[model samples]
Structure formats: structure tokens, C-alpha cells
Target: MNPRTVLVLGASGLIGRFVTDDLRARGFRVVGAARSLAPAQTMSALDIELPILALDTAALKRFLGKHSVDIVVNCLGVLQDGPGSSTGAVHRDFVARLLQAVADSGRAVRLVHISIPGTADADRTAFATTKREAERLIAASGVPYAILRPGFVVAPSAYGGSAMLRALAACPLDLPETEMATPFQPVAVEDISATIAWLAARHIGDASVKAVAWDLMQLEPVTMAGVIKQFRHALGTAGWPLAAIPSFMLDLGAKIGDLASTLGWASPMRSTAIAELRRGVRGDPSAWIAATGIAPKTPAEGIGRHPATIQDKWFARLFLVKALIFASLVAFWIVSGFIALFVSYRAAAGILIAHDFPPAPVDPITIGTSLMDISIGLLIVFRRTAAVGLVAGIVASLGYMVGAAILTPDLWVEPLGALVKTGPAIVLMLVALLMLDNR
Candidate 1:
């Protein structure tokens, strides 16, 4: 621990945070990395023992050059679509770049990566593929590496707002007689962390420096039927009932979760999370435990160790805030565009009336088309195109609203406030268009 530095990516994550704390307590100098500065600050302020690093893989080489890291731990994972979302290109590309940087740096003792338990033939989900690819990259890096795959990480109560669980709890129904009899094997989060901490210290047989693995949970195997019963019992939902959803129905549910996940700023259930819940994987952690001498803890012991408790309501709140901001921007754009269009119409009308020029039939249709574009703007409210789309929205709304206020009827609103609020968005679009033209 003296000169050995451990670099943990995605340090703000649940298991990642636990692993960081575990390593830091054992006297290891831990350098933690996350995409955002807020969580980094929280980790630093709470645990002064660990230093924080921003998750910029391109900067890894420069950062590592300043500090000597013995092992690089990749605990950065997601269940969403991409890097910041679930786990997509952001995860895959970053791992690839980080491994490449580590190889070039010629420093670091080993690369410890966290992997979900599965082979190539298992789940073809992007999560499995990205993780498998990450593992392959590290193993091929000529660096010593060890992979740990844990089983169902359990918590005592509601997880991610656990609305479904709550719905079950509140119901007056009969419990699912079949699921109450199934098996389950859960592992404590700390035990999983400890396994990594121990394995990081011990270099077992063959000295390959890279160990591919399946963490096989340390619990008496329980069935899904039993797990549901336990959940009901735990929640005091005695009379509540559950029907064994067919595998096809379960897959449909997952697809539904995925399809609508982006509608809000935060989602309680990621699309992929459903599949993980429906399917069970159990393995023997004996080799890993025996090799490192770190036993897996039971779910009862580890559930409370996780710190961050997410609720569905929180996701809803975040979505509301995001939606509000988006809606305001769109409103701003619409208002401004209408003002501009009305001004254009008045100028054209005054000229035509003065000269006795005829009006074109397309004028009304042009205004109508612009209005239609504004409605579609909401489709991209939570997407990357939000900012630009807002500008389009402003154009659409302002075009119609101003025309209605001036040329058509008596609808009054403060033009000054709309102008001030939406002016920046219009300018942003101008700048973006210029950039696009230059490109």
C-alpha cells in the first residue's frame, strides 16, 4: 500500500463505491474516477482517504504519469443505453481507450475488471457484449488482470423506487403459490468487494496475471418462486398474489421498459434490468474464494451495506424538472418565431395593400407547416438534439403565435419577455448552422 496506487473507474457507482472504500481502508491509495464532478466531490469530502479522478480515458495516461498505480480497476458499468445512460459505446470506447493507454504507459501492475457472469453464448445483450469485449481487451493488453462476476446483489427493501414491490405490498390478494417454492442465492456487496480486494493482493497459480471468472454466489440456491414469496413476506403482502409471467411475456416487458426509458430524465427501470431479474445465474465462488480466501457474504448480511437508495419517485421528479426546462425552451422558441413571422406578414401586407398586390394562397399553409414542426419538438426533449430542437420549436411557436396575435385576432402576451427568453436559443441555432456550414 505504500507506493501502490489503485485507480477505480466509475467510482461513484454502488459496487464501485463499496470497492473503493474497501481498498482505501486496507491502506491502498485509491484514485477514483466518475464522469461528473459532483459525485467526485462527494466521495472526496466523505472519504478523504481516496483521491478523485474525472472519467476521461484520454487523460488517463497523463494522470497515471503523475501517480504510480499498481492496479487499474474497471468497475464502471451501466444497465442503460450508453455511457451516461445504461452501458453502450461510452462504456465500450472508454474501456478500450483506457486499456490502450495503460498498455502504452508501461506502469500499473494488473488490471482488475468487473464482469457479469456469462459466456459469449449466454446473453447477447449489449451489456454482455460490451463487458465481454472490455474483458477481452484487458486480457489481451499484456497486463495482469482478474475478473469477478457476482450473483444477485440484494438489498433489504425497495430498490430503484421499487414501485412494483410497493404495488404488491398494497394489494389485497393471494400470494403466488408456485414462486414461493423456488430457490435463490444472493451475495453481499461487501463480500464481493472484499473478494476483489483480496484477489488484488494475491497472485494465484500460473502467474498469468489475468483471470477470467464467474463469481458463483455463496448462498444455498433458492428458486424464483421462493424469492417472490420472501419478497411478499418481507413486505407483509400476505394475501398478495403473483402469476408466473411467461418467458415471452417477460421479454415483452423488457422491450417496453426499454422503449419508454428515455421519456424522462431518469428511469427507475432500465430495459435490460428486467431480463436480469427474470433470469438467474448461480456459480461456485469456491475457486475464487479459496484462491483469495475471501468468502461471499449472504444477502441478509450485505443488503444494508449499499448506501444510495433510488426510488421511482425520484426518477419522476428528475423527469419533471427536465421536462419543465425543455417545455420552457420550446415555448420560448415558438413565441419568438411567431413574433418574427407576424412582423414579416404585416410588412408584406402593408406593401401589398399600398400597391394593391394580390395575396398568395401558400401563406396560410406555410404557417400551418411551421406549427406542425413545433409539436414534434417534444419528441427530442430528452435527447442530444434538445438544444437545437428548441430553436426550431421557437421558430415554430413564435411564427404562429405572433401571426395569431397580430394578423388574425386578439391574443395578447408580453413580447419583451418572450424575446429575452428565446433570443439566446435563436442565436444558438444561428451559430450551430454556421458551424455546420463550415464543417
Candidate 2:
């Protein structure tokens, strides 16, 4: 086959990075893209010089046409974000879009799609929903695509150092008295990628360069706890500390992710990651291994050669945790400010009413003034010059309160209510400004 050029979407992700490296090492040209600058910068060290393209369809179409690539290795993944938004979109949607774009070109391309194993079952998981949907779209498009469904991916490099392993590496490893039966064989990326490269190029007698899902199971199904131990031992560290990141907590974390996103924080509480933590997920890769006849890398072996891998991951995780703490502080301040505004406005309103029971229109100018204040107040989120924004927010809020007070002179609620109403915003503002100035 000609020197095949491959495009990998979500190429900056865990699996996507591995796949891109694997393809490049085997002498194939690979172009990658991910919606993150950190990962894009990190990718440059891999010795693979492919430019990171934007994952947008228009950009991709232009690239594909310009490059005239032979294959499309779609490591595309999604975590519940919409087309351009991030709440309702899925990987499958992106895959479907990619497939249609390729199919319409009439250039008969080979597709290597990396899908999660459980995605085969359309009923169980949301990730699966999109993966399955993407697969369906690919199949229906009459495209020659090979699906690689990897099971529990255990990175030996992640042993004692991975977030999962670290979470479990600090205490007495405990197994549930009643464990569910979600068996899995954690397969390494190298094994899965090798199989994909082989399959993408190998045109079978009747396979038509397109095959169904390749179940890239490790050797056997590993229970959730067992894998945790595997990671603990892999890290050469013991006394795993079990952090039971509950589903509810995961959802809560996801909610908080909105605030985190401002600082370029990726959602750690992925549904799939959470699902694995909860009940465990599994896959059978017998068909995959048999077809390719390749031995998968054990977690221990990979980590042995690359100890820094474990160390780097650990450090990165700690850094992110610190970032999250900073985010939390910012979020608390924002919420407190919102509450202050609400309380202040209500109290001020109460004092203004004297006619019969309630007061009447405060007028559009007053309302607009209040809204403009709130909007400008939004900028206090910035660390430097935050005092200005806070002052603006507080003054606008106070203006609303004072305006209400002027309107109703005989209302029961007194000046105390107004003070209390503005207390949080004022206190928060004063303290934050003082801290900034002291620094």
C-alpha cells in the first residue's frame, strides 16, 4: 500500500495519542487533532510531526482533499457535548459526520474506528449509545471500516501513579463482598493499534477492507478491584487508598465542571470512567487477538520500561487537583455574591412597599441599571483588578437596594436589612481586595 496518511480525531486523548504513535512508528503518516492546547503541546515530544488539525468538518474536509489520505483512523471520542456546545454531543455523532464526509468523496477509504467494548450493546451505557450510533452510521454509509473495541485499558505506567491506582494505592485493598460480573481483559494500546494497522491494510478475501468490531480484550476479564490491585502492584506501591467516587459525586463533579472549564479543566468525572469505577466494565477480545495473532503488553512490562510515565501522570494529576481547588474558591465567591444580590434586592423591595401590600413598577431604567451592574459584576472572576469588578457589582446591587428604599419610605424592613443584604458581596470584595493588595 502507498504510504498511508491517517487522520485521528481526539488524537490528544489517552488512547488517541497511543494510536497516533503506533501508526506513525509503523511508517504511516498521521495527522491528529484535539480541542486542547496542553495535549497538543505534549504531543510534539512524541517524534510524530503531524500537524494538529481542527476537528471541525469543514476544516477536515479541506485537509482530506488536500492530503488525499489513504486511511482514516478515527480515535474520535466525546464526553456529552453538543455539536459546538458541551452538554448533549457524543462521539458517535462526530464519527457519523466523519464517515459521511469521507463517503461522499467517493475515494473508498479504509476506516479504523476505536470504540469502547460495551458499545456493542446499544442498551447499557451512554458512551455506547454514541459509539453504537457512530458504528451504525459507518455501516449504513457502506464504508469499509474496522471497529476496534478495547476493553479495560490498564496502563502499567498508571500502576501506583494513575489517579485510579493512587486513589486505591494508599490503604488496605478491599474487595466487595458481593462483586458483579463485569469481566474485562485490560488491553494495552500497542496491541490494539497493531491489530488496527494490520487490519486497515489487509484486504480480506470477503472482508472488503471493512470488518465489524474487533473485541480487543486483554487475556481475561479483570474485576474492578482486581485491576485496582494490578495498578497498585504495577506502581510498585502498596496500601492502596480506596476513594469511592460515588456516581452522585461524579454527577456533582460534572456539574462543577462548568466552572472548571473556564480554566481549561477537562471533566474528570467521565461517565465511562465513573461507570468503570462503579460496577466495572468488560470485553472479549478473543476474536480480535486470533485474527491478528498479536500478544498484548502487560501493564507491568510497559511501566517497567517507562517509569517516568507513571511519575509524570502523578505530577500532572496533583497539579490538576490544585487547579480544581483554586476553581472551587472562585466558584464559592461567585455563588456567595449571587446570594448577596438576591437577599439585598429582596430586602430593599420589602422596605419600598407602602401603598397597600406590594409595590409597583420600579421602571425600566432601574431594571436595566441592575442588569448592567450584574453583567459587569461577572468580570470579578478575573484575579487581577477583581476589586474593580466587585466594587462595580456591589455598587450596582446597592443602587438597586437604595433605589427601592427611596421608593418606599414607610416599609417595615430597615437599613439593617440593606446592610445584611450587601454584607456577603461587600465582605467578599473587601477581603479579596485586601488579600490582593497585601500580595
Task: Please give the distance, in angstroms, between residue 439's alpha carbon in candidate 2 and its true position after superposition.
Answer: 30
Model 1, runs deviating above 4 Å: 1-3, 37-41, 45-58, 80-91, 155-184, 203-216, 228-253, 264-271, 303-439
Candidate 1, 1-439: lDDT as tens digits: 2646777776666566667777888877787766543333355532323222233555677666766777777877766674245465545777777777777776646777777764567665677777778767766767667777776654333334233433333344322443333244666666777766765676434363365565747746765444434444444454645454455554564564565455543433455565555445566677776676666665434432232234433332233233344455556445534643565656534433454335674456545554555443453344556545655655754675566556543223445454344446555544433322100
State the displacement of the C-alpha of residue 26, model 1, in Å, after optimal TM-score superposition. 2.9
Query: What overall lDDT, based on C-alpha atoms, would model 2 receive against the true structure?
Result: 0.56
Instruction: Estimate every model's Cα lDDT from 0 to 1.
Output: 0.55, 0.56
Error of 1 at 366 (Å): 22
RMSD from true fold, candidate 1: 9.8
Q: After superposition, how far is residue 127 of candidate 1 from its true place, in Å?
A: 1.8
Q: Which ten residues in a row have the lowest lDDT in candidate 1?
A: 430-439
Question: Count of backbone clashes for each model?
Answer: 27, 19
